[model samples]
Structure formats: C-alpha cells, structure tokens
Target: MPHRTYLTTPIYYASGAPHIGHAYTTILADALARFARQSGDDVLFLTGTDEHGPKIEEEAARRGVEPIELCDEMAARFRSAWERLDIGFDRFIRTTEDEHKAVVRAFVQRLHDRGHLYAGSYEGWYCVHEERYWTEKDLGPDNTCPDCGRPVRRIEEENWFFRMSTFQDALVAHIRDHPDWIVPEVRRNEVLGFLEKPLGDLSISRPRSRVQWGIPLPFDDDHVIYVWVDALVNYLTASGAVDPSLGPEAPGFEDPTGSWWPADLHIMGKDILTTHAVYWPTLLMGAGVPLPRHLLAHGWWVVGETKMSKSLGNVIDPLQLQEQYGTDAVRWYLLREMPTGSDASYTPERFLVRYEELANVLGNLAQRALSMIVRYRDGVVPEGDAGGLDDAVSTTLDAVAAALGDYRLHAALAAAMDLAREANGYVEAREPWAQAKDPARAGDLDDTLATLARVLGVLAALFHPVCPERSAELARRLGLSGVQTLQEARTDAPGGRTVERGDPLFPRVDV
Candidate 1:
C-alpha cells in the first residue's frame, strides 16, 4: 500500500498582510506535497487564514469596519497571494467557516466531557497583541508580551481552562519515547527543557464581553474560545473529524483512514511548536484522537537578523516577488536556499545570483543539446545503445536516482543537471558539427545525440515536481509524454519520440 502524507502551514493571522514568511512555509509544504504525489503517496496539503482573535478585532475597529468584514477582505488577499504563488493546496480553510466552528466546538466539548476542562476565574496580564494572558514573569522587561512586544493589561474574568499541567509528564515521556517526532535535535531539546519547568493550566476561553470575535464556548455563553484552540482545530476540521456528513471530501480526501489519519507529518514554524507539538498532541490525547506521527518545526525567515514584523516595515509581499520573478523561480528559491529546520534570509542580490546560475549554466546546457539534435537530426530522437555510450552518463544517472530516493531534492536536481553538463562536454569534445561532414563518424553522432536525449529525459522527470510547467514543456520537446515518476522515465522509455526545439527553459531576468 502507498503511504499517505498531510502537510500544513499555520493558518496565517489576518490582522497582518501575507508576507514572504507566509509564502515560504506554504510553498515548502506545496513542494513536499507535490513530491509525495510524484512518489506515489496520497497527499493532503492544507493552508488558510486565522481570522479570529483580539488583534483582528482591534485592527477592524481601528479601520472602522466590522471584524467579519475585515477578515473577509484579508482572507481574500491571502487567497489571491497563494493563487499567484501556485501553492496547490488541497483545501484553504478559514477559522470563521461554519464547518470549522463545529469542529472547534466539538473538540472543546470532548475535552470538557473528559474532565480535562474546568470553569474558573482568572486574573493575569493579557496582551491584546498576543491574544494571550501571560504570568508576571512571562512578561518582558517593558511589561509587555514577550513574543509580540506589546503592552499587557491586567484583567480579571471568568473563563474555561485546559488541564495542560496534568499532561506534563505524559508529554515529556512522549517526547522521550519518540525523539524523532520533533525534528532537529535542538528543537526537541528546547521543547523538553521547557516542559521540565512546572506547567501551567492553559486558559482556553476568553470572556465574550471582552472579545466576541471567536467561536462561542460550548458551555459558557459569556466567553469565546481562545485563538490557539480555534486555530488548531483547522487541522481536524479540514480532515472531516467534526462533520461526519462531509465524509472523505475533507483535505486529505483520498485515504482518510488508511494513510491520512494521524498525519504523517505536521510542518510548522518554531514559534508555534509549543502549540502544535505540545498542546495539540495533548489535546488529541485528551480527546482520544490519534496524535500526529511527526511535528517538524522550522526556523523563521528573519529580516535583518530579526523576525519579520509589520511595525518594522520589513514584511515582504510575496506577490511582488511572484510578479517580478515567475512563480517557479520564487518557489525554487525558497526550497533550494533553506535547509529544513534552518533560517534563510531573502535578498534581491542572492536571488539574482541563483537565477543566473540555474538559467545560464544548467538550463543552457539542456537547451544547447536539444537545439543541436533538432539542427542535425531533423527533430528525430536518436535511439541509445546502452552498451555503446560513454560510461560517465550511466554513472550520473545512478547517482541522481539515489539522491532522489532519499528525499534530497536539491542534491538530486544537481546530479540530474550534471548529466547535461557531461553531455555538453561530449558535444564540445566531438565537435558534432564538424563530425557530421565525415560519413565514417556517423555512428559517433548517433551515439552523442542519443546520450543527450536520454539525459534530458531524466532531467524532465526529476524536475517535474519542482517546476511542473517547465518540466512538461521539456518533456513535450523531447518527444515524451509528461512523466509521472522518475522510475517511469527510466524504464519503458520513449526511445524514438519526435523532438520539438523550443525557447529557453529558464529565461534570464535582470535584477
């Protein structure tokens, strides 16, 4: 049976506009989803906007608009941006959606019924920006929210709380038993160390009198669910956990139980690991739902050595990049430059450098090889004699296949391109144009053309997920159908398909 993979980015908060960080995570998820599909896995990719919370309410009020109106407009902007970026998400969920509300309510009621929730009166320093109440020491030096750098107001209210403290040992033990569940040894250590301290009961509801922009609590009429609780349920809601009527039409619609239940991986930014890796699993455990198999926390994309912030005016609009550079270029740069679980900086100079190298060096080689075949072979794909070609071509294909099998996309792409580089050298050494004049060297020309076609076919397969449009174009030009898998390209090959010489694969851009 094939595997099932579900990947998601944190539902982005709508109080701020979409930025490069948003694009980075979503695009990474999209690439992973695409790769999984190519590798014969059923993939569910979810992305969306988080439309509730105090920050959103404040932004709406400041703009003299209702919260729903504000969310509608911001969510549209996010949708437009993702569409422009070609993020092939399985579903775009909104926290304000009716389906989502039902899921959140059900999730909360499950915990309540299990005795994991309690009605309580609480007093603490609340950060409107963070939409979270913080203990006195959790506040920063300026008496503000530590994460958001905003002033906190001391408030007292009646609310519902989750017994997060009750799960401390279980969470710790879970982490210890499944060390690989949390990615990058460093992040796992950080989560473990944080859990070593006394855990606090998490406030799960906010007084509706104070905030009315969230999902209403199941038992309490005066309070709405907190942002994290409202937001995190999106994962389940998108999977049809809340509404039995929806059936498999949910996000990972293909194999809801077999491969899709208990997600194979949950990708998130480091800031939310506590919520996703810690609170989320605990919530699942309390509700008797299966915990996700893995939680991979990646670092943030920092601007000028600090996290991107709207106040600093450093938040990058991803659409601008998509418009200036094509979608595939932007997508490739995000995945290629950032190592999983590491931070990557975005700069125009760096992007331009990479574009030039890929376009001029790797792309040009394939173009030249095909262009030569069209010029000399009358657009006929010459058949290869596996026993007759240079040994280097076979060696490169073996290495490329090995890299691809291991999920090393960047390395695999490089190895695949190296075949083109070798073919180019062979063309240079043989001087095919000069060799065409001698009838004695006819076999040499056929061998060279065949080798080039074989290498180009392999590249089309390897690059299909990363650059789908370009790969299809290349495949058509090489007289082959759009390939679905690397293995398909290698076996039962299209040996004598007609070749179409077209424009350059990666067009050069001036930065």
Candidate 2:
C-alpha cells in the first residue's frame, strides 16, 4: 500500500472575505499535497470555512440578514476564490454541514462522559471579534483583547468548562518529548512560553441567550459549544473517524485503519498556534482519539509593517492578482517569496521580481529548448546521449526532496529554480545553435537538443506542484499528456516524441 499523507488548513473564518493570507496557506497545502501525490503517496487535503461564531451573528445583524445567509455568501466567496487559484483540496468542509454537527455533538458528549467537562459559572473579558475569553493578565494595558487589540466586554454567566488544566503537564511532556511536534522553532518556543503560565480550564460553551449561532451541547441545549471547539472538530469530522450514529463505543476512535484520522500534518498561521498545539491535543486526549502527528504554524503576510487585516485595508485580493498575472504566477510569487516559518512582506516590486525570475529563467529555457528542437530537428526530440545533465538533475531532485522533507517550501522552489538556471547555462556552454550549423558537429547538436529535452522533462515535474497550469502547458508542448514524476522523468527517453514550440509559459508583466 502507498503511504498516506493527510493534511489540513485551518478552515478560514466566514465572517470575512478571503484575502492573500488565506490564499498563501491554502496554496502551500495544495503544493504539498500535489507533491506527495506525485511521489506515490495517497493525499487527503482539507480546507473550508468556519461558519459558526458570535462574529458571524453580529455581522449578520449588522447587515440585516440571517447568520446562515451571511455564511452562505462568504463561504461561496471563499470557494470561488480557491477554485480560481486552482487549489486542489480533497474536501472543502463547512461547519454548518449536518455531518459535522453530528460529529461535534458526539465528540463533546464523549468528553462529558469522560469527566473532562463540568458546569461552572464564569466571568471574564470576552472579545466578540475573536470569540475568546481573556483573563486580566491576558488583556492589554487599556483592557482590550490581547490577541486583536479590540475592546472586550465583561460577561458573567453559567457555562460549561473543559478540564484543560488537567492535561497541561501531559501536554508539556509531549512537547518536550517530540521537539518537532510544532514546527518553526520560534512558534514552538512561543507555545512553550505560554505554557510556562498555569494552564486554565477552558470555557467550552456559551448560553443560547448569549450566543445563538453555534452547535448546541449534546448534554444541554441551553448552552452551545464554543465556536473554536466546534471549528477544531472539523478535522476529525472530515477524517471519517468516529461516526456519531455508531455511538461512543465504536472502534473508529481507537483504530483509524479505514480513516484518515491522526492527521499527518495540520497547517495553520502562527496566530492560532495555541489552539492547535494546546487546545486540540488535549481535546483529543480527553476523548481517547489519537492526536495529529504534526502541527506546522506558518508566519503571517505583513504589509506596511503590520499583518494584513481587513480593518486596516491592507488585505491583498488574490483573485485580482490571479486575474492579472495568471494563477501560477500568483502561486509562484507566494511560495517563492515567503520562507517557511517566517513572515513575508508583500510589495508590487517584490511581486514583479519573482514574476520576472519565472519568465526569464524557467519560461525562457522552455521557449529556447523547444524552439531549437523544432528549428533543427523537425519538432521531434533528437536521438542523443542525455548524460550531460544527469548529475545536475540528480543533485537538484535530491535537494528538492530534502527541502520538502523539512517543509521549507521556498527552499524547494529555490532548488528547482537553480536547476532551471543550470540548464540555461548548459545551453549557453553547449552552443547547440553553433553545432547545428556545422556539418561536422551533427551528432553534437543531437546530444545538446536531447539533453535539453530531458532537463525540460524533469523541470515539468519539479514545477508542477507550484505552478500546475503552466507546467501542464509545458508538458503538452513537449508532446506528453501531462507532467511526470521526477523518478519517471529521470528514466524517460524523450527522443522519439514530437515537440511544439509555443509562447512563453510566463509572459512578461509590466509592473
């Protein structure tokens, strides 16, 4: 059986529209999934909208519409944006789905039965925007929510709480035991620092009177499960683990054989590190469900020295960029510009720089190689020894694999780009055009064209995950139905196949 890799992006909040930040995360996940599939791994990639929360309710009221209506509109927008960007997610889950609600109720009921939940009276600062409670120390100096720096409200009411504190020590031990459980050393250190403080019990429910737009607790309809809890269960809900209709004694929770539970990777922004690293693992432990293997917390996309935010009007619309520069260009700029685990600043100058790199390097090489093949070899790949680029291709493939193993997306892209540059240099050194003009060097010309064709084959695979559309076009030009894996391309003899030279894969863009 092929190895299975299950990956997920934190479902985007439906209270707002999709932005470049959302695109960045989904694009990264999509690239990883595509690469995994190409490498003979079964991949399950999940992405969707977080449709239930106090923020949604308030926004609906402000717009004079039902909450579900708002969620419907925003969810559609997200779906459309992702489709436009060519994101190939396996499942686009929504929190409002009947199946998801069922799983949430079942999971919560198990926690209650396991004595991890209790009824309690709570009073603290609550941020409507973030839908989270903040203690005195967690608030800003001006008594605002620390996370969003927004004014918070004080609400004292009866609610149910999770015994999150009980698992604090265990969580710490797990983090210490597996130093790589949380990625990007900085984010891991951040979680550990947060844990230095005593872990407090989490308020897991809100009274219906206070919040009417969340999943009702299975134990009590008067109180609904908090939005974060409802949202986090989405991964499990999509994993096909623990069918709610089968009751709590089912084997699905203990054995995830037929399901994709215990997800291999959970990808999200650094802002939500605590929820995934701390809240989620403890919740799984409470319900006797296996925890995900890894959590990758990536940095945000900042603009003007501030994180991109709708309120600040700094959000870049990825759809617009795709419209102007093509889907692959947008995806390339994002993956190439941002180093994994670190924040990246967006600027038109930088965008054009990355775009030019593609057009001048990969695109130019593709154009030159195929055009030369057509001019000298009648649109057919020449029969020659392609061993000239063998060592370089092997080295590049190894570097790409190693970079991807570490989840360094930018590094992987750099390695592929380096191979393109190397191939271009090879074309310069070999001088296929000069050889074609010399009757005495006919065999040398064939070797050069054949070596270039082989390198193009390898490139089509290396670039496919990041820029599927253009890579497919390049493969079609090379007379292949689609892109092949690096392994397949390494042994592929490109000689009898007919080639068609065409326009540049990435056309020059005027900034």
Point to the candidate with the largest TM-score: 2
The best candidate in terms of lDDT: 2
Error of 1 at 488 (Å): 1.2
Q: Which stretches of candidate 1 lie over 4 Å from their true place?
A: 242-259, 304-306, 386-437
Ten residues in a row with the worst lDDT in model 1?
247-256
For candidate 1, give the lDDT. 0.76
lDDT (0 to 1) per candidate: 0.76, 0.92
RMSD to the hidden true structure, all candidates: 3.5, 1.1
Error of 2 at 477 (Å): 0.5
Lowest lDDT sum, 10 consecutive residues, model 2, at 246-255
Deviation of model 1 at 250, angstroms:
16
lDDT of 2 by residue, 1-511 (tens): 9999999999999988888888999999999999999999999999999999889999999999999999999989998998999999999999999999988998898899889999999888889998888888888978898878889999999999999999999999999998889998888889999999999998899999989999999889899899999999999989998787976665777787889998999999998989999999999898888889989999889985887877888888898999999999999999999999899999989999999999999999999999999999999998888778999999998999989987999999999999999999999999988999899999998999989998999999999999999999999999898899888898778988999998888988776
Residue 257 of candidate 1: its Cα lDDT?
Answer: 61
